[model samples]
Target: MELKEKLNILADSAKYDASCSSSGSMRKGEIGSAHISGICHSFSADGRCISLLKILLTNVCIFDCKYCLNRRSNNIKRAMFTPEEICTITLNFYKRNYIEGLFLSSGIIKSPDYTMEQIIKTVELLRYKYHFGGYIHAKAIPGANMYLLKKLGSLVDRMSANVELPTEDGLKLLAPDKSSDKVSKIMQYVKNSQNKNFVPAGQSTQMIIGASRETDLDIMQKAEDMYQNYKLKRVFYSAYIPVNQDKCLPSLITPPLKRENRLYETDWLLRYYGFKVSDLLDDDNPNLNILVDPKASWALKHLDEFPKEINKASYQDLLRVPGIGVKSAKRIIKSRQYFRLEFKDLKRMGVVLKRSKYFITCNGKFDLNKEFLKKEFIEANLVLGEKANSSSNIYQLELFHE
Candidate 1:
């Protein structure tokens, strides 16, 4: 088949993999440079939009993952890109300023080792033969040979071995061919490897949300484990999109976009704001509140902790307050050293006072009247604010754009 035809087929097939962000990798060589920015119009840590040419090496698979569109039983057009073809496309796209890097994933071909070898060969061709040194994020085939995984890690900026479902039971029910242990082994390998160059951007994994019967607590606990044990760079949450009919899978018409957003917000809390999974969830409340963001939900429940005096609260205390993000919290700390802060100053410092006002007091003055401090009133207003900003609350990792 022609290269364009192959590209069209493989790229479309690769769309479901959401672990394609390309931040935290920086490499410069003769042909291209991988910046700290991400792919698919994603903003970097420093907030610059970038793009990548995301595609699959091949769509033919040995495993029949029920959630996957390219599962062996599915009737989809199959295409494979030779190592030379991939290098050609990546370099051409880089030279034309169309993309800053490549995000490559593939289905298991003959075996895990064979598929991994093919992917490694393609990356090797790009790095050594063409001197293309852009941000390449490759998927590590779970159960691939250890040597191949290490070799691929050295060549690419980032690598991921997706733990497709949240729990072992979910894996057994929906994707029996895959094992959570294999994915964990890959992460363990990346973590234990002594080589400084092994995946300089570190490793990340993707988990499909709302697929099986796992609660948000189950998913976040799993993510927290990956972060603590594997030292993973990211644990991407892709809301399940019903593509194939199966008795085992949820028969939802639309993806649970709100749940996905709440997960991301909760993830941010865990990573940056020093929140434990236990702090936000319990046996009674296993799932996140879909109405308000995780931080706001927590603030509403723990009203006794508020209204924290803004001027006297420590940096950690400031972060715990609703609507105060990392940047704004830091700003609050640095600015409070200069003068006594008030509500107007917080708004200027980028705090979402609509939510924070219910929980914080600026210099002994309540932003809202004490009568409005009731949990029901606060929850209602927060929910209304969330509905007003509903369009912007949904977060999905964009892998490609026209």
Candidate 2:
């Protein structure tokens, strides 16, 4: 098929792979600049605006991963882009200022090594032949040769190997060809190859949520293990979007978007806030409280920790208070050094007093209405508050073409 048609097909197929974070990269290309902070519009570190050409090299696959849209059993129009074609597309797009970088992934064709070679050739053409230094994020094919993985890592700024499912049983049932051990080994290889030029942005992986029977606690524990053991930069969560009818797949019409958002929030807590997996969940309560955020849920469960003195609280203590994020906590600390802060000052400093006022006291004075101070009332309010703040997007799915 022609390249534009292929682009649409492959890009749509690649949307399921959510490991496309662009943090931890800094480079001055011949055309544009890639900051160390990040390059993508979403999950950007330094708030720098940038776009990526997110597409797959090919939509043809040999493995019939039950949960995947590009599986071999799925009768979909297939497309593959030659390495030179990809380099040309990237350069032309970059020249037009359409995108700053590329996020390339692909399904296996011929063999793992051959498929990986095709991906690496695209990167090689972009970097050496075209002298394109824009940020590149490539996926390391699981079970591909270690040499190819290293070579690809050397060419791209960021590399990732997706651990698609959370549990081994899920892998066995849905995706038999993919093994957790292979994905883990590839991640270890990337972590060990953190030199000056090779994958300078570090590595990340993705986990498909709601596809299997794994609990939220189980997923969080696995993420914790990946962070500690692999030293991964990020663990992305993609809620299952069931497109094909299969006995192994869940019968869902819509994606578990709320679950995905809550997972992202919980992940932020684990990464930024000093929160453990156990702190957010227990043996009895496995799923996250979707009505309230993870931090707010924690605060409600441990009410004794509430009414923390804002003036006397440490920076860490301030972080524990609901609605006081990292920036607000730092602001509180910095502003407190100059003079005592009051409720108005907290609002000026960017604290979300609507949530924090219930958990904090300014100079030993509770400013909330005494009638709404009950735990049940506060919980109900938080739920309503979440619904009021939630927003949804509607995406029109393109008609299937062959």
Off by over 4 Å in 1: 39-50, 194-196, 391-402
Which digits, one per residue and each the tens of the lDDT, describe model 1 over residues 1-402? 999999999988887776656778778889887777654545556233447778999999989989998999999889899999999888988898788798899989999999999999999999898888788889999998999988999999888889988899999998999999999999999998725477988899999998899999899999999999999989989889999999999897568766887899999999999999999998899988776788888888888888889999988998998888899989988988999998999999899998888888987989878999899998999888867765542322221110
RMSD in order of candidates: 4.6, 4.9
- Among the numbered candidates, top TM-score falls to 1
Alpha-carbon lDDT, every model? 0.86, 0.84
Off by over 4 Å in 2: 40-50, 369-372, 391-402
lDDT of 2 by residue, 231-281 (tens): 888999988889778998888766777777788889988888888899998
TM for candidate 1 is 0.93
Count: clashes, candidate 2: 0
